[model samples]
Target: MTALAVTITHEPARTILTLDGELDMVSSARLTDTIDAALYGGRQHLVVDVSNLTFCDSAGIWALLRAERTVSAAGGTLELANVQGILKRVLDLTGAARAFRIITPGQLTSP
Candidate 1:
């Protein structure tokens, strides 16, 4: 199983969280914590860069959904970037893609 790593960076208008490795039940909490930190840090726009994400299970999807809910509740927006491979297929097949504001790397410019 690939280990999960979440790296967070603060930008002028948003917070970017780059997720690498696997996101399963064991690592979902870490993602949640990172999301909470970014939101509480007073960021209204969150960009989750999943380019390095290698794997994701149902729990991972749940974690992303939960983050979305939390961000929306705080009047912020959550966007998913660079979703590809199996992760992209999972989101598409599950119709969860519509739940997030999906963007390409080219669109993730400073706002």
Candidate 2:
């Protein structure tokens, strides 16, 4: 299994976290830590780019949901970008897609 990798980029108005590898139970904490750090740093808008993510399990989905809730409760917004293939299918299958603000990569570049 590929190890989980997370790269965080801070933009003027938002923070973007690019996730690669498997987002399973073992790697969920990294995501959670990244989310906490971003929010704690006063970032209100967070964009999680999962275009390079190789795999995602139920734990990953739960982590995403938890991050969304945390951001929302803090009066912030969390968006998932470049979500495709299996990850997208998983979200659809779980009926959890509607709960998030999904966007394309182009949207992130727009002013």
Best by lDDT: 2
Off by over 4 Å in 2: none
- Across 1-111, the per-residue lDDT of candidate 1 in tens digits comes to 458998888888788899988898999999999888887778889999999988899999999999999999999999999888898999999999999999998887665
lDDT per residue (tens digit) for residues 40-86 in model 2: 99998999999999889999999999999999998999999999998
Scored by CA lDDT, what does every candidate get? 0.90, 0.92
Candidate 1 residue pairs in clash (backbone atoms < 3 Å) = none
Clashes of each: 0, 0
Please report how far candidate 1 places residue 51 from its true position, in Å.
Answer: 0.7
- Model 2's number of clashes is 0
lDDT for model 1, please.
0.90
Candidate that scores best on TM-score:
2
